[model samples]
Target: MSLKILITGAAGFIGSNLCEYFVSMGHDVLGLDNLSTGSLSNIEGLRLKDNFNFLKGDIRDIETCRKAVLNRDYVLHQAALGSVPRSINDPITSNDVNVGGFLNMLVACKDAGVKKMVYAASSSTYGDSKALPKVEERIGKPLSPYAITKYVNELYADVFYKTYGLNTIGLRYFNVFGRRQDPNGAYAAVIPLFTKQLMNKQSPTINGDGTYSRDFTYIDNVIQANEKAMLTVHPEAVNSIFNIAYGERTDLKMLVDLLKMSLSKYDKSILNIEVIYGPVREGDVPHSLASIDKAKRILNYQPQFNLRDGLDEAVDWYWSHL
Candidate 1:
């Protein structure tokens, strides 16, 4: 059955992919974006679908949010200021957009009586914990403004679910990277950044001796989690948070090597590129891995792509676009 779906930040990497997935599946998609960090090009491809509609606006405004939420069945809230370094540079903007804007959307959704709300949470919520595989039940103090904003989203979601009977699910994403992830920004993720450099035969920078590790998730896995969270009829699954990541870890050094190897298939010059190391940026977690057992047990979530396969696809995308 096709349903009306409203996606905030629908021009962003993850959000745009979600819009594409739902629109392709025959859902009526209303894509709202301010294009702050997002690009109109992201959703321009979706215009070919008759069921898709695009709205240009910011989530920080209550009226804009209300207009987008009215009569919407499910709201996939993905708008926010991302990047820890960027947050450190400008915490106020981060708080305003990620926290204040998030609250505005929540209020609008509650008022609209939307059936369910699924949002993009972050692994930065795990903060300074030394745990190898982060679990939802245990979380440490947030180290950065970005982390704080994401944690607050989860808290507010819980309160809305309790106070207004609004169903909400938060997916704490961990280094989600794949096609359409922008590579031009100074704060771009390692995969897209490196893929661009390698394709151009330039050395990629490896922050903090390349030992910093992450459970880099593919976009398809996140899309699967969102779809299941929005469509699942299981009552036990509503109003909770799930770690949306593959249960595997890859260090930055290994990731650079893999990128080179993957790109080598298309361009031989990529194999000769050397990785340069730099001091770690402030607010960066040394290591992160996610426990997906909760999502697996409840949402029946299964990750179809791992690091290597995901890297191959991501490199291919940058190769084509760049």
Candidate 2:
């Protein structure tokens, strides 16, 4: 069955993928973006599609959010300023966009009487805690401005559900990377940034001693989690947050070696590229692993790709495009 869907940040890496996936399913999908961190080219093919429409707008504006979210069946909210370093550099702007804009979207959704809003939450919400496999119910102090905004999102979502009966599901996304993820930004993700550097015969830099590990999730896995969160009929699935990841962890040193191996298929010289180590950036946790048992038991989410499988595909895409 086809449904009306609103995907904010529809021109971004994750948002664009959601837009394309839902559109392919023959749903009436409306995409909203400000083009700040997103690119129109990401959804360029869908530009002429019959059922997909793109609205150039920001969620910071209540009117814009209300206008875009009106009459939507479900909203996949992925728009946000995403990066600890970027947030640290400009905390004010990050707060305005992440917190204020998130509030605007919630209000608009409530007013419009949307069905359910599945938003992009962050794993950084589990800050300062030394837990190995991060559980949903337990969280630590937010280590960065970006983490605080995401945690605040969860709080607002909970209040909206209890106060106004607004149904929501938050997915605390770990390191999500895949095709169409920009590799040139000042805040580009580790995988893409490293892939780009290797493709150009340049070395990739490691922020720490290459010991910092992460639950590197693939974009497709995230999409699967979103769909389940959006469509699940299970009563317990709504008004909850789930950690969306592969349920595995990989250190930076292993991550770089895998990247080199994946890219080596295209260019053998990539295997020779050395990794550079530097001082750890602020607000970075030494290790991050997710307890996907909650997601799997609740949403029945089964991630299809692991780090190795996804990295190969991502390398292939970057090799051809970049």
Question: Using lDDT as the measure, which candidate wins?
Answer: 2
User: lDDT values of the candidates?
Assistant: 0.93, 0.95
lDDT of 1 by residue, 1-322 (tens): 9999999999999999999999999999999999999998988889888999999999889999999998999999999989999999999999999999999999999999999999999999999999989998899999999999999999999999999998999999999999999988878987888888877778988888988999999999999999999999887788899999999999999998888889888978778888889889899999999999999999999999999999988888878888
TM per model? Answer: 0.99, 0.99
> How do the residues 1-322 of candidate 2 rate in per-residue lDDT, one tens digit apiece?
9899999999999999999999999999999999999999999999899999999999999999999998999999999999999999999999999999999999999999999999999999999999889999999999999999999999999999999999999999999999999999799989998888988898888998999999999999999999999999889988999999999999999999999889888788889888889899999988999999999998999999999999988988988898
> lDDT value for candidate 2?
0.95
- Alpha-carbon RMSD of each model: 0.8, 0.6
